[model samples]
Target: MDGSVMQDTDLAVLLHQVQHRTASPEIVSSDCSASPPAVLPKRVAAAFASTDGDSDSGGDSLLRPKKLRKPTDSGGDSLLRPKKLRKPTYAARKEEIAALLEEHRLLQARLELLRQNVGIPTSYDHDTLEAAQRQQRAMEEALRLQQFALGNTQSLFSKHMNALEPNPLKTYIHLTTDAVERRNTLLSIRREKLHRCYQFVHERLHHIPETSPYHVEERYVNAKGDRIISRFERLLFPGVQDVKQVFNALLFYLTNMEISISETLGHVTVRDDIDAVETRVSNHRVVSSTSYGIELELNAVHCYEYYEKFEEMGGQEFAME
Candidate 1:
């Protein structure tokens, strides 16, 4: 009977302790509801939730899903937005008009200056001025030819000869049929002489060594040493016996015919006529050739002398219709 009573007492005390523990939580919850709940700092709550592993049951309510933030693009927004264009102000329009007027004034000034420089009168039309210039040039050319025919060598046209202006009067005087025939005959005789001289020089060069100098270099050495003399120098200063004889014959013909070598290359051709006589001396040989038109003119004195020589040479005469 004593053991039963003790067991019932222990059982009742354990049940009362269990009921008290369960009711104590309800009372605390009701008190928390009745008053305002205690606010925890965000950083403290986050630290407590992360550090305490058992906080899932209680702290899950404190952490609502973080509100997602959309990414911002300022540059893209600015680009997508339409730009508002401002209307031009009265002052800006006035400035543009002023600048255009200034440019117009400058262009007009330049045009006026150009007209003055070109000697184009404001009253004259451009085509009229051009026609006048053409007429003036024709008159000048006519006057020049008249002066040239009258034996005026100091004419304005002759002064500008270096400017490459062709003289029609000179061409007419030198390129006539009679002039061409006489010049061709004279040139043929000269050509024959040149050929003979070339043959002699070519033969002489063959007899000399390859090392023998043809052109003048080191005057003392060339004059003293066994160097070949150029035809030009031989013609000018005849030292060798054979060269003197050859040049003497050429001089006699030149004097009798009254023909002068006016050019450095021993060519006598009319002005404005293209004539070339190329002669290259190298390697014991003389290669000479001529090209283009050959023309010349003779005075009355020379013409008589030329006919006399032609008769002496027994040239056949032909009548021109």
Candidate 2:
């Protein structure tokens, strides 16, 4: 009878300990039952309840399923989430620019071919057309000023040339079909040469490894073993600027020369129909493949030399049309 009473006392103590351990604020709400908690097995709860107060005694080692951590929790689980992929802005821009540059080159080639075949080139870009028109206007103004200055000098050549056009409209009406055809032929030749020179420059730029920093780094070496960041910038930036200046000068002078020569021929024609024939005879200028004569007359001294250098480098020779 005594042993049974002691056993009953031990069972009650075990139940009390388990109830105390499992009584978290979450589990001990008013709605929770006073009976064994639903999460724990009845046998496991009974076992833990019989243990001493010391946590190291392992009475709480029941294998209840672990609750998954919330995403907001500061735990290693958050680190395992996949990060979003970033956009490749640099690569995307590089490709876009390369495509645009290629398109520009193709358009330039097509324009040249059209100019050669039909004597008229098509331009799609507004800025390009505007720039060409502006350049032509400036050339015309310069030619007019030059004629004015020449007239003031009262030179024999200038006097006779001006004497031809007593009535500008009548002179225009008297222009023979042959003279018109000759002028058109000369203009076509000049346009073809200028276009070829421009194409040479453009293709030269595209071929130059030094123009790009990435290409420069690959091929060029600094023998002094110094750092090359500054050198690379110097090689590409100022060099490109110089090339651009050369290109602009070429276009300006070539256009000016073409306009001036054509204007002179027109004035000479107005003076006497036979003067065009005489001028052609005295000049004895057959349309030579060499642009040296025209280039020299305009004092674009470096133009042909620069073209030759690029031609050699690119292994491309310009053929006269």
Candidate 3:
């Protein structure tokens, strides 16, 4: 019986030591130096501890699966959450946009105003307007070129005519002895004829009645101190007809006189030369004439035809009245 009691006490002591080692696992690690302490998983340790009748309900709290506590707004743990992007707003650029819109409005208004002033219809689009502007520029350029060409032609023609004109003051010293006397006689005859023609024109002018169609104006004097007729006007009368008739009569008379003189001199070549010079000079004068009222001038082609007809007619007098 005593032996049985000793065995029971020994069993009780072994049971107490196992309970102490399980409660404090660090003591088992320190006391045992020969082998490494075996680690028990939290689940296994909690299961073992739960079997102990003396273990408190709260003893397994450390091993229980932890309930995750959500991070608070004030905590640094909130930094782990993904940030949500805020939508963009145009409020910051509102002033800039408004200013740009205002400027665009003003520019549109200015463009419209410019179009109106330039005579461009509002119905025209940008492309049409640009085309019109280009056309206008082209027309202006063409007109400028035309004027330039006209100016150049006038100057060149004037120089050519001046060069061709014979100087009345020049002496014919280079003429052969045989032709000199004949040439002097022809020149004297031409001078006398010209003086007689001038006297005839002067007499006609002086004889014009107060009620006559022709009204002559003496405004200046010529280089030879002779009075120059500046203008001729027709009297306002019931019977006053076309002034062209009077001009035709005078022209016919002068042309006939000139032909008569040339025939008397027996110089057909000189007459032909004089006709050509007169035609050229008259044509140039016609082109340059800016006189008002009666259009007495004829173009070069017409002047040529007029001289041909005059020659064909044998210098017949054209009746004025």
Candidate 4:
């Protein structure tokens, strides 16, 4: 067998074995991490020159073919390799994914807004806001309740007071009765101290004449500072004792120690109702001397000596006892 033919036969056998294998084609590998080989590009081939024997002259070298690659003029070492596009990518079905992502973003925003709204206290902020509102409402309600209660209390108080008012005529009448009661109680008391005090005051009792013992004397002063005296009769109501004057003067003289009745007694004389005179003189016991002047100014108020001492009911305390 010829050597060349034997070499050719071996090469053919190897090629046949490689073509029959079931494995699919492999992608081209690159060491520089350049893009994967494209379908077509400018091809570079290895060159060789032939040396002519015995001289520096050269003949054409063998034309070596090279594997083609894709080219890019862009200023990048490499571009991202596109993955082999699948059915989803090839069909361009991305609208649904975009919509889902958008919905998710919206949900996050809604959750943030819900956190700001007031509700049952899950946190301190919510608790504070709710408590403040509750307190404000409670204060308003309390104020309203207080006003209502005040109104009701005022109305009730007024009604009660009105029902309990004392009558004017009965008021003075009651005062006189109380004084009589005091006198009787004091007299009845066996206590020597109380009896002595009551008797002393009791003797001063006299019916009050509208006229007073004191007189107002008016004097006119000249520029030289000298004074002139105008003497007047004691002012009197004619029938107070019914005797007019003389009897009042006698009683005044007899009862008072140093106290002098006004001199008007010398001018007017005589009387008829001895009992009336006696009654007037008798009513003056406790209050007459002190209260008389005040009575002149206080017309609206009528003064009566209601009690000289306590009533007989265990001594005297008029209103209370």
The whole-model lDDT of each prediction reads 0.44, 0.47, 0.49, 0.40
Query: Which residues of candidate 4, in runs, are more than 4 Å off?
Result: 1-123, 165-182, 185-321
Q: How do all models score by TM-score? A: 0.17, 0.17, 0.26, 0.21
What lDDT is reached at residue 40 by model 3?
Answer: 44
Clashes of 3: 0
Model 4 lDDT tens row, 1-321: 699797667655543442232122242123212322343121200001111121123221121124466666552334655557566773455876788889998986677567767453344566788999999999999999999999999778545533433411222212234655644443333244334434533433334343575343445554456554533334445555433244445445444422332243222222222111222222232112232332111111112122335565355432110
TM-score of 2: 0.17
Candidate 3 Cα lDDT to native? 0.49
| Ordered list by lDDT, greatest first | 3, 2, 1, 4
Better of 3 and 4 by TM-score: 3
By TM-score, highest first, what's the ranking? 3, 4, 2, 1
Model 2 clash pairs are 164-271
Candidate whose lDDT is highest = 3
Tens digits of lDDT, candidate 1, 1-321: 999798667656654553343345444343322322136344334433353343245543243244567657986688788998776798789999999999998998888778878986643466788989999999999999987777665454333532332312122223234655645644444434444544555554665554444542221123235332223121233364543355346535434332234344455433221222121110111222224445444332111111212342255331100
Between prediction 1 and prediction 2, the one with superior lDDT is 2
**Stretches of candidate 2 exceeding 4 Å from the true structure:** 1-9, 12-92, 114-321
lDDT of 1: 0.44
